[model samples]
Every structure is written in C-alpha cells, then in structure tokens.
Target: MNVPLRDPNIVMKLSRLGSFHQSKLSFLRSFLKEFKDWDYKRDLFELNEHGYGIAVYSFKKKNRVYSLICFANELDENERSDRVIATKWDAAFTLFDGVPAKQDIERLKNEVPKQEFGRLSFKELTLSRANKSVRIFNHVVESLSKGVQPDRELLDKVGYLYRTTAVYGSGKFGLADRFRIKDRKEIYGPFRLEMMLVYLVRQFTFDQVNHVAKNKNPKKAVKLDPEICRNLGIGNSTGLGMAPFIVNHPTLLNNWISARETSLKKIREIKNISNEEIELFLGCLKKSIKNITSWNTESEYQIKKIKSLLSDLNKFIMYLDKEFNFKQDFAFNEMYLDLEKNYCEECIEYVVSMMMEPFDDIVTPLIQEMSSEEGKYFNIPTERTVAELKAILENKYSEILNIDFSKKENNLNFWFISKNKEEPRLANRFDENGADLEQPLAIARDVKKLYDLLSVSKNSWTIAKFLSTNNELRHVVRRAFIVEKFPYSEIQDNTIGQEIMPIDMLRLKLSFFGALKFDPRSDKWLRICMFQGAPLPEQLKNYDEHWVYN
Candidate 1:
C-alpha cells in the first residue's frame, strides 16, 4: 500500500511544529550514535576545593579528535545572571578542533570565561557558558560530603546542576567558520560539535560536584552514584534569539520536517510487522508517557498543553488496548488516520515521533539528509515569467496571501537585533522605538506584499523585469522560488502578528535539538532540559538506542 506524505499546509503550521517531540532522528541521539565507538578520555581536572579551575574532556578516533576545554570560575551569587547581559558565569567552555597545548589552554583561560568579550582562534569550534543551579549544586555537594546521596525527589525536580544560558557555534565570536570544517564526514550532522560540548559539559558538572564534595571531606565524601548521574542532564535557558533560526535557515528547517514526514509516510506503507518490532514500538510508546507525566511547568499555557497531551494520550492508549488490532493490513496507517480524527495536535505529533522507534532502516538514511547545502538554493529563478511566479505564491502561500497586513494587529510587532547582546529580539511596532531598524524576518507579511504587487503585473513580463522595479521585495521572491522547490521551507503564518507567541517559534527549533521539559518563563523566553535520560559517555559504546523513552 502507498501512503501520501502529509500536506505541508497542515504539518507546517507553527502550532504543529511547536508540538513536535524528539525522535530517533534528533541530532542529540544521532551524535551519540555516530561517536559511540570513539575513545573517551578526561585528560585534565584541575579544580580547587570549591570546583573553581580548569578541566578537559575529549573524544578521539584514528586521527580526528575533538576536545572540550572547561574553565570554572568564581561567581558571586549576586553577580550571576542567566540573562544575556551578564558578564560572569560559574563556568565557560570551548570545544577545540583537537587536543589543546599548554599555551592554548592558557590563552583561552583568560578569554573563555569572558564569553562574548573573548576572542577565539579558528581552532575553537563551539563556545558556551553555564551557571550553576546554586541550590542544587550546593545541596548535592553537602550531601555527598556527608556520605549520603542528595534527595532523589529534589534532584529529579530540578534536573541539572548547571543550566547553560547559551551555546554558540558556526563562527560567532571568532570561532572556526563552518566552511573550514563542513567537509568532516564524522561531523557532517548538524550541530554535532555543539552537542559534543554540551554532553561533555554534563560530565564536567558531575565531576565538579564530586571534586568539591571530596575536597570538603576526604574521609566521608562519596562519588555521586552513576545511576543518579545518568538521570541528570544539562539544562538551558533560551530566548527569542532562537526564534529567527528557522526563519533564517529555511532549507535546514525543511530538511528536518521533511525527514520526520518521510519517516511517517514510510512507516504507514508497511504491509506487515513482526512481533519484535511491535513489542519495541509498544514498549517505547508506554515508557515515553513518563516523560509527559513527569513534565513540570508552571506556565499556564504549557500546563494546558501538557494536560491536553496527557488526556489525549490516555484516550489513544485505551483505544489501542481495547479496540485496535495490529493484525490488520496497513495497521499503522489506519491508526494514524484515526489519531488525526480523534486527537489534538500535541497527541498526534507525539505519537508520530514514537512510531519511528522500531524502524532503524527507515530513519538512518533520513538523518544524513537533514543537513543542507543552503547555498544551492540562494539564487532566484528570475528568468521565470510573472505568471509562473504569481501562481507559485498563490499556491504555496494560500493562507498568507489572505492575511490583511493593513490591520494594525497584523503589523503589531517587529524583530530586530539587540545592540547590547547582538542577538535577535522581538518588540512591539507601536510601543518600541526600533521599528525602522526591524530586520527582514516578516516573510509572511512580505510575501503578501509581493502577491499584491504581482497581481497588477503583466503576466507576460519576466520575473527579472518585474524585479527591476519591485527589487525591495527581492528577499521574498528568492524565498518563494525556494519554497516552490521545498514545500516545508516557509512558515505559513504571520511572524509579526500581535498574537504571536515567540516561545512557539523557540519551541519549534529546540524540539529539533532534542530538548525536553519546555518550561516557559514568558512569551519571549523559556527553560528546557537536554540529554536527559541519555546514556553516559562511557556507556555509549554499548547502550540502548531507546534510552530516550527510558
């Protein structure tokens, strides 16, 4: 049986994208899987009694090596701030292209802790800074120093000892330009180096806590149990800066959503399923429920989302247990159709991620396709006629063309880069002073503008001639052609809408990174946990690929 891919109009909605959960294709899981056989080592640990010093961790293969150099510093409680404006953090790190020398470490020691103000050579691939969860870190240290484990309930509530405020890569702050390392086969996967930095950082946190505890009481201190360390992951606080990523990298965005949709389409086409595959699917589905039930969020909006997801999942599980039969042909296809009719977007997308767990053959190739050579689509097809361009916009942007941008509410907000932090920020058009400085991120509004202008254009005129006069809308024209080839390339909603939830945009991007526990602090920023329930570095050689559900 052949099953068609889900329409982009339905699957590309911001609401559906925001509800996306991590699957086997997630970069974090793929990162671990790719480097599972690489040699792991901690070549240096020089922290003082308070865990304020330097450390180093690395993953080495036959010739290629990537090292994470860590710098732990003293941060007074009053000076530590997770907001981007902060100057100091508990620790800062850089993932070097290979192992570093004494001079290289000394050079970064003075600069890494300075973060943005610091200068990094091309050898540093990724840079990041994390602040300690002071309460949790101290509690763990105190408990371990007294020869006891910290309260498991408390540890699970706040999942990490440190939460990174930002992770920067791809040449930001003088790091190595991606062009320099883009050809490395092992690191071809998106954000592979960044994931390595964070995963190694997770290990650093455990080591630092143990170091501090042992220093406090040499006689009674004990190492944190490996099981408990496995439960903890690195947390992160992300802001509107991430919202523009999907808009800026449309091809990358398309590849991510495309991989997922392709997986679902292939899974639905299967004519038969073996008992082992069914058991693995059932096991992952049942265990993933814990991720939802244990989800902790104080935001009323997120609380509502979680409640509906849990509620719908209960109904779906009951249907499977009491009514559905796997013996039927094209069973998953039928189950998916039924889900769309009966479930919320959150529940439906959640199940879509779970459905891929039992099919490694379907997912492995898709992972390679997720990275994009975006420059291939940069040039617009200006030789096409206005009539062809008009039809493309009309078909591809059916919903966007209907939006009334003249409405005050439709033009209520603008996106701009902040002068202080040099990061993406969202602000009100009427209330904020930066409207004139607004970045060209409002693709929906601009696409509508293009469509309106193209309406009166002569159908016989070439797009190159049309652009000679309407050059101001050239960006959207380039995007329109890109979207013509890539269906999931453009977001079909108004990014400048008064009702826009910037968190929704952030959530969409983070979901692709395998982040969990989306606890929104506001409409502009949120906190999430990554690498939770993932295997430790030493165990990566022989670990369960299904650890995400565990």
Candidate 2:
C-alpha cells in the first residue's frame, strides 16, 4: 500500500494536537535511547550539608563531555516559588558545553540563579532551575532521617521533589546559540540537553534529600529506595510561555507531528504482526491504565476529559479482547477505525500511542525526523506571486479566514512579551496597553487580513512588492507559504479568540517533550512531570525501551 500520510488539517486541530501522547518518538525518550551508551558520572559534588554549594555532573563519550554545573542555595521558604516571576530558586543548573574548571563554576554560581537577568557565556548549552516542592521534599527528608521511605501515594500525587519553572536553551539568556552544537550527534534530538538537565536534576533532588537526611542523623538515616527514586522524575511548571514556541517554530512543529503521523501511517500498513509484538502492544495499553487513573487533576475541564477517556478506553479494550482478531490483515487499521468510532479524542490518541509501542523498526526512524532547522524555512519565498500566496491562505487557512476579527470575542487577546522578564503573556487588546507592540502570534486574524488585502492586489505582484506595503503581516505571509509545504505547521483556530485554551498549545509541546501527567493550573498554564518512569542515568546503557509505558 502506498498510502500518503493523514491530512494535517485533521491532525493539527488544537484539540487533536493537544490530545497527543508521548511515544518512542518523543524527544526525551529518543534522547535517552540515543545516548544510553555514553558515560555518566558525578564529576563534582562539592555542596555542603545544607546543600548550599556547587556540583557538577557529566556524560562523556570519547572527546565530548556535557557537564551540568549545579548551584544549590539556602532560600527562605518565602523566597521559593514556581512562578516565572520568582527570582530565587532553591537550585539553579546549566549544561556546560564541556567539563568546567573551578573558575567557570565560580562565575556561573553568581549568574545562573539570576535566570533571564543573568548573562551566560558561549560555554553553556542550556540553563534552568527548580524550586523545591517543599511539602514533598521536607516529608521525604523527615521520613528518610527516621529511616523510612515517604508514602508512595503522597509522592506520586506530586510526582517529583522539585518543579522547574523554566528550562532555557537555544540562546535564551545569552547561552551558546544552537548553531554552536546543532550538529552534535548526541543531541540531534530536540531538547536533549534540557532533558539531560531535568534528568540530572532528578538525581540532584535525590542527592539533596539524602544529604539532608544523612546530616540530620548519620547513624539513623537510610538511603532512599532505588525503586522509589526511579518513580520520581523532574516536575515542570509550564505556562503561556510555551504556547508561542509552537507558533514561532513552524518547521520544528511540522517535523514533530509529521514524525508521529508517519509512524501511524507505517503501523497501519503493517501486514504481518508477530504474536509477541501484539502481546507487547496490548500489555502496554493495559499497563498504561495506571497513568490515567493516577492522573490527578483539579481542572474540571481535564477531569471530565479523563473520565470520558477512561470510559472509552475500557470500551475499546473490551472490544479488542472479545471481538478483534490479529489474524486479520490490516488489523491495526481496523482497530484504529473502531477507536475513531467508539472512543473519545483522548482515548483514540491514547490507543494510537500504544499502537506505536510495538513497532520500534517504524518508530525509531521517525524519532530522527522530529528536530528541525527552523532557520532554513525562516525566510519568506518573496519571489512568489500574490495570487499564489492568496491561494495558500485560502486553502491552508480556510477555517481561520471565516473568523470575524471585528468582533470583540475574536480579537479578545494580544500576545506580548512581559517587560520585566521578557516572557510571553496574553492581555486584552482593548483593556490593556501594548497591543501596538503585540507579538506576531495572531496568525489567523492576520492571515485573514492578508487575504482581504490580497483580493485587491494585482495577481502578478510578487510577495516582495506586497510585503513592501504590508510589512505588518510579513510574519503570516511567510507562514502561508510554509503551510503550503507543512500543512500541520499552523493551528487552524484563532488563538486570540475568547474561547482559546492556551494550555492546549502548552500540552502540544509538552507531549513532544515526553512529559506525562499534565496538571493544568488554569487555561494559561500547567504542571507536568518528565522522565517519571524512565531509567536512571547509570542504567541507561542497557535500559527498558518501553520505559514511558512502564
């Protein structure tokens, strides 16, 4: 069968894209899979008993070494917060390009914690920080000091010892530009260093807890169980800050989704599935129930979705067990059809994820397709005629064109960078100031405007000529042509619409990061856990390929 991939329009709906789950194609999982055989070590651990000091951890293979230099500080409980506004964190971390010297650590110790305000040099690859989940951290310390593990239920409820507010890479805060290390085979996967930073931070959390416990009473203290340690992963608090990332990195977004859709297309084309692969896929689908049930969320929105997803999943599993036969050719295709008819978006996407679980031969290659050199597509094809551009807007942005931006609800919000932190923020265009300085995120409205303007222009006029008079829609014009090639690159809805759920954008990016257990705090932000069930760095050499499902 020579099947073209699924249409990007159906796959790129904000809700459908948001329903995505991590697979072997997820960046973090792929990163671990790619770098498993590289060396892992604690190159430096110089923190005091109070955990106020510097530490360096490294993963080296041959001549290359990526070191994570960490600085732990004693913050007043009041000083610790998970908001982007927070200036002080209990800990700050950076992935150095190579092993750092004492002088390098000393300079970084002063600036790294300052975050966005800090000036990082070219030697750094990525920067990030995490505030202690005080309740869990203190409880774990108290329990271990008394020689006991903390309750798994309480620990699982929060899912991590620390929650990172932001993980900055690719030139944010003056870090080494991505051009510096884009070619390194070890990190060709997107967010690999960020994953490594979070992974190492998970280790740091364990080490910090163990250190505090040992200091409290060396004789009575016991180490945290490795099993419990494995269960805990790094937590991340994401907000509207992540939403524009997808909008800005269109080709990157296309690569990620294309990898997923390509995997699905390949799986559907499989003619013969061995009994073992079928068993593995079903096993993962069944075991993943824990991820859903234990998925605690206070958002009534997510709660209802989860309830519906669980119900649909149960129904689909029953149908598979009672009615479906793997002996049939195109069995996975039939299963997918049943899922689409009988399941919620959540359950259908969930099953799609499970279907990929048994096909590494298919999934592994797609993993490499996820990362993109966005700059390659950054320049507009300004030589093209106005007619070609209009056709693209009409075809690719047909749904978007119907939105009447003159309505207050359609033009409800404007995305801007917060003056203080330079982070992304959404504000009312009429009520709040700075709409004049609005970031180029309102593609739907702008593309519609571009279409209206194009209607009056000469069809033979080049984009360069049109842009000379319409520079404001330059961003969306560039995007219209891009969407011609990468249909999944643009969201089909008006992002500034009153009904927009900004977290949907965040969830799309998080899913690609291999994050699990999204806990949305509001329509604008959410908390998620990463690498919760992943192998520890030491065990990466020979680890479970199905760790995400585990």
**Per-candidate total of colliding backbone pairs:** 0, 0
- The best candidate in terms of TM-score: 1
* Model 2 residue 123 lDDT score: 98
lDDT of 1: 0.92
**lDDT (Cα, 0-100) at 354 in candidate 2:** 87
Q: Report every candidate's CA lDDT.
A: 0.92, 0.87
Candidate 1, residues 45-141, lDDT tens digits: the string is 9989999999999999999999999999998889999887789999999999888999999999998999999999999999999999999999999
TM-score of each: 0.98, 0.97
Record all residue pairs in model 1 with backbone atoms less than 3 Å apart, i.e. clashing. none
**Model 2, span 1-550: residue lDDT tens:** 5557877667888888788887778878888888898899998888787777888888889999989988898999878777788889999999998889889988898899898888999999899988888889999999999998889999989989988888889888889998988888778788888988988888988888999998987999998998899899988888888899899888888888888888888888887789998999999988888889999899998898889888988888888899899979888887887787877788888888889988988988777677887777878988999999888887888777888999999999999999886679999888988999988898888888999999999999999999999998888887887888887888888889888889889888888899878888888888899989888888999898987767
Off by over 4 Å in 2: 420-422, 430-434
- Colliding pairs, model 2: none
The local lDDT score (0 to 100) that residue 279 gets in candidate 2 is 98
Candidate 1 Cα misplacement greater than 4 A, ranges: none
> By TM-score, how accurate is candidate 1?
0.98
